[model samples]
Target: MPADRDVLLSARDLHKAYQLGRVDVSVLRGASLEVGRGEFLAVMGRSGSGKSTLLHVIGALDPPDRGSVTLDGQDVFRMPPRGRERIRNRDIGFVFQFYHLLPELNLLENVLVPGMVGRSLTAWVRQRRGLRRKAIELLEKLGLEHRLQHRPRELSGGERQRVAIARALLNEPRLLLADEPTGNLDRASGKAILDHLVELNDGGQTIVMVTHDADVAALAHRCVHLKEGQVTSRHDPRDAERPVQSVSRR
Candidate 1:
């Protein structure tokens, strides 16, 4: 973490485990991390390294067996279920490897799901226009305007992922959490998604991504590697002097 940057999210001494049949498999052990505001941080590791678990913990999707997470000075685990849900809906947006767009909903409607989650029928009716406009704008920004009415099954892998990204940005979340966002795409498609993420980060959207690909991780400002549930190394792709303009192909 940089000394001059403001910390937007922090986790300390995190520990988690799961019960698999009759055995307990420990995942995270004393993991700690701090994400600065407007910073693009990448978490990288091999399969079963607990990278996904770490992201879920910080994003409040799953609770850690022990340790604490603070987001923008508020204790996340300490909040009630409703409060945590609010924070998840209002402050954080998530993108995953699999585009989880609803099969029955069109791209635009899927993007609007988060906004409609807790609203009453009357409230939704009143706010529908504005929300629809925002969703359209986001889809356009992601180059998916023409596909707004198309269902997920009608789109390609890359296009569906782009739609997922658009949906994540619809709420103008303070933080974006992406887990293996390009794992399901080809090299070119993956590069395009990473480029979009870079553009968003340059425009002041904070992001934390988990990826196994080193090439993808290079796009981030800083990256931390995990091994056997513990942070093993941290590095800046720019070598600590100045930031690089873009990721290099290798």
Candidate 2:
């Protein structure tokens, strides 16, 4: 969280649990965080620290067992089912490590998925042209202009990840939540992805990225460590401001 900017996202005393067979697994226990407007923050933790679960709850993808998540000024959990779905579609953008692109769809079509969701056929027809232009611009900006007609299977790992990012930005979301965005990429590819993320943050796109690697997390403006189901540390690495990621290969 940046100290001088307005708060854009806030999670207060969050608690989330999962029922695994007969066992009750508590994932988040009173975890709280705040992100300033246009801030890029990273959450770093080991496996099973519930970083992904926290992102889902805040992004309206999953409901928390207790507590609340507020985006801008609206309470996320208090919204109706349709409203929350709308939030997921229009308010928050998600970039996953796996690059969840539909294999059958081409790059151009894949980027347009968010705009087509929750729209009537008539509405889609009316808005498709503008959305198409926006998608083209995003893809081109991400250096995918030549691959617009290509399917996911035809692209490289970095190229596929770029398509995922373009799709996430199609709706012009208020918050972008990335889960292990560089986890599956090679060192060079991972650094390239981080560079794009840095460029987005510079353009005032508020982002919350989750990663286990400290070097990858250092790319953010501020880093928080989630330990034992809660955020227990906060630091800003003013030294490593460049997009150089020295992540270890797993």
Can you give the lDDT of residue 128 in candidate 1? 93
| Model 1 lDDT tens row, 1-250 | 7453499998889999999999999999999998899889888887888999999999999999999999998899998999898888878999999988899999999999988976779988999999999999988988999988899999988889988988888778889999999999998888888889989998999999998877677788877877767775544443323333344322
Each model's TM-score, in the order given?
A: 0.92, 0.92
What is the Cα-based lDDT of residue 51 in candidate 2? Answer: 89
Question: What is the overall TM-score of model 1 with all chains considered together?
Answer: 0.92
Output the lDDT of residue 213, model 2.
Answer: 78
Judge candidate 2 against the unseen true structure and give its global Cα lDDT, from 0 to 1: 0.88
Clashing pairs in 2: none
Write the residue-wise lDDT of candidate 2 on 1-250 in tens digits. 4463498888989998899999999999999999899888888877788989999998989888898898878898897888888889998999998999999999999999999997789989999999999999999999999999999999989999999999999999999999999999999999989999999998999999999877888678777877767885543343234432532221
Clashing pairs in 1: none
